[model samples]
Target: AFFITYTYPRTAVSFSEAMDWTPGQLSGNFLLPSILEPGQTYNVRARLETLEDPTQETDTDWGVITIPEAPPEVPPAADIRNLDFGAAGGTYEIGER
Candidate 1:
């Protein structure tokens, strides 16, 4: 028998389930959640155990890295050509002009 385990580094939640495998099945597939935290990595893998004894089990290496969320795009700042004293004039002083 085998199962899948998903670990969340930021949260205490753990999702696990038994795989639907046949007596001679060699391949399997799993679908994970679509949305994950940005700049974070989650752990996911499989585990196998003997039907006769559950204690005799092994864990496979983590084989997937969830796609990271892209950072927000920011526009470039505008350059200030000169200091302009608005209509409210109060003896404005320009420096290094």
Candidate 2:
């Protein structure tokens, strides 16, 4: 039996699942839950049990993983070269030029 656990840093969010192997099963897969956020870091670890005994289990050190962050957005730019400030002080909104 194999037990895997993942935890988000600095919060109470976590997800865990288990897998049991038969006599000939060699591969398994676990789908990530939707509660996890993107670009956030999380700690992960796994424990393997032998003969369903708690005292005969092995655990790995916690590992770090981070999801990719979204790309930045760029605003539109104007190409006006010459501008007149008129007289002294005045409030100007966008596209007032």
Candidate 3:
């Protein structure tokens, strides 16, 4: 008899329901929710059951799922400060200094 099962890692609120599988082996890509924020974590779970006889069938296994944090955010160039000496110099006066 052959059986198939899937498992996911712990993650944040964002998670993927659609999964895929290969021949004999189990594998799939998860589409995470867009609402999920970057750098956040989540948990996931999955299970498999056999369809043999009621008395013979059993819950094969169970595991936890995890969703990785999103990529880092890049700041705009305009928001960055220009530290070049030639660009500008200190504006402090003798009294201010």
Candidate 4:
């Protein structure tokens, strides 16, 4: 059997106090009173502290928390036509492309 563990940093320096995750089956998803500001970045970290037996304790893993970017100013439907199909189709042959 296994259990979920959720943890994060105690302080907020570059980011606001609010942060969250998306929909799925896992750990660390919570709603906040405020939304993240535009053009900002945040970093959060967590670890799993586990006990294999009554006498032994261990930290299984650690991970950085991700806060997804905000939606673009234009809606999907409105910007669908403006998409450049030529650039998206991988037709450009260059050093990087």
TM-score of 1: 0.29
What C-alpha lDDT, on a 0 to 100 scale, does residue 23 get in candidate 4?
A: 36
Q: Kindly give the stretch of ten consecutive residues in candidate 4 with the minimal lDDT sum.
A: 12-21
Q: lDDT values of the candidates?
A: 0.48, 0.46, 0.45, 0.43
For candidate 1, lDDT tens digit of each residue in 1-97? 5544555432222224464443432343344554544666556554455544557654454553333344444566866786665687488678787
Q: TM-score for all predictions?
A: 0.29, 0.32, 0.30, 0.29
Task: Give the number of the best model, judged by lDDT.
Answer: 1
Structure candidate 2, residue pairs in collision: none
Q: Arrange candidates, best lDDT first.
A: 1, 2, 3, 4
**Cα lDDT over the full model 4:** 0.43
So what's the TM-score on candidate 2?
Answer: 0.32
Candidate 4: residue 55 Cα off by (Å): 9.6
TM-score (C-alpha, index-matched) for candidate 3: 0.30
Q: Write the per-residue lDDT of candidate 2 for residues 1-97, one digit (tens) a residue.
A: 5544654333222223454333321233444655566566555554444544557654444542233443344455865675555666789566855
Descending-TM-score candidate ranking:
2, 3, 1, 4
Show model 2 residue runs off by greater than 4 Å. 1-27, 64-97
Give the per-residue lDDT of model 4 (tens digit) for 46-80.
44333334244323222444556554454446556
Clashing pairs in 4: none
Q: What is the C-alpha RMSD of each candidate to the true structure, in Å?
A: 12.6, 13.4, 14.1, 16.0
